[model samples]
Target: MENDQQQKLISELVFLIEKGNAHVSMEDAVAGLPANMRTVIPENLPYSIWQLIEHIRIAQKDILDFCVSEDHEKLAWPDDYWTEPVEHIDDQTWENALNEIKQERQRFFDLLQDEKTDLFSPIEWGDGQTILCEAMLIADHNAYHTAEIVVIRRMLGCWR
Candidate 1:
């Protein structure tokens, strides 16, 4: 791809991941959540806001790792990706988790920004996935979970 085309593609991916043009951004979905409610699972819901938050962090990190690392081991389904609700989360820990998500997201953005990273080339490892595929996967996965957080908040009467 030409330099201009690559830069444009990277710009679009960044916006898709960060701007929440089609749904609530992860940050906005969790912002101002009551600490008391973070671990409260709504009726019929399998996970809490806290679990969803952590799941997003874990899954995003996994995909980012896959995109960049040839040695990345595949994570087990359900077990590796999902988390049980905790009894409580301190403010600092919660903030740290959120910051980890932010930092990992920035790392992915940096990968895209690098001129040498080929967005369309297939991975040489187990799959034929390309950086473009991985980028869209991250965006889609985060958006889906972020929407779930919003729905759970609304169910708990906590959403504004």
Candidate 2:
């Protein structure tokens, strides 16, 4: 559990991005709330609102795994198959989605002390010199779509 500056930066980046995701998670986790309002999409798209979450979640997991194991092939996603799909999920699907996202986010942060690797390994599709770069990328990815969902929710009168 070393508290180095680099680890702090990674943790902070993860926190910032996840905070953005959490802002919309309340509305995003609303099951079948509305196709546009809900974060998880129920169809085949590069990233549905939920898909974005899943994509971000899996991306973080995959990247961390890739960095530690050098199993970058584990990062190989199918053609046009980036986000994990969840169509016609049950009534409580929203809860599951929320839990999954939160768990993955926490798990990514938990690696701070245990995994001593430099956080700068380039993740798939990452432009930065380290995982911290992609950390922001994932956060920005969620932020972008979460904003989209927020707009949709507003249009649906679900805005606070």
Across 1-160, the per-residue lDDT of candidate 1 in tens digits comes to 7888889889999999987687878889988999999999999989999999899999999999888887887899989999877889999989998999999999999998987888888977736898889889989998999999999999999999
| lDDT computed for candidate 1 | 0.90
The TM-score leader among the candidates is 1
What lDDT would each prediction earn against the true structure? Answer: 0.90, 0.55
Give the per-residue Cα lDDT of candidate 1 at 102.
Answer: 92
Which candidate has the highest lDDT of all?
1
Q: Among all windows of ten consecutive residues in candidate 2, which has the lowest summed lDDT?
A: 36-45
Candidate 1 error regions (>4 Å): none
> Which regions of candidate 2 are displaced past 4 Å?
1-4, 21-48, 72-87, 121-129
| Per-model TM-score on C-alpha atoms | 0.96, 0.60
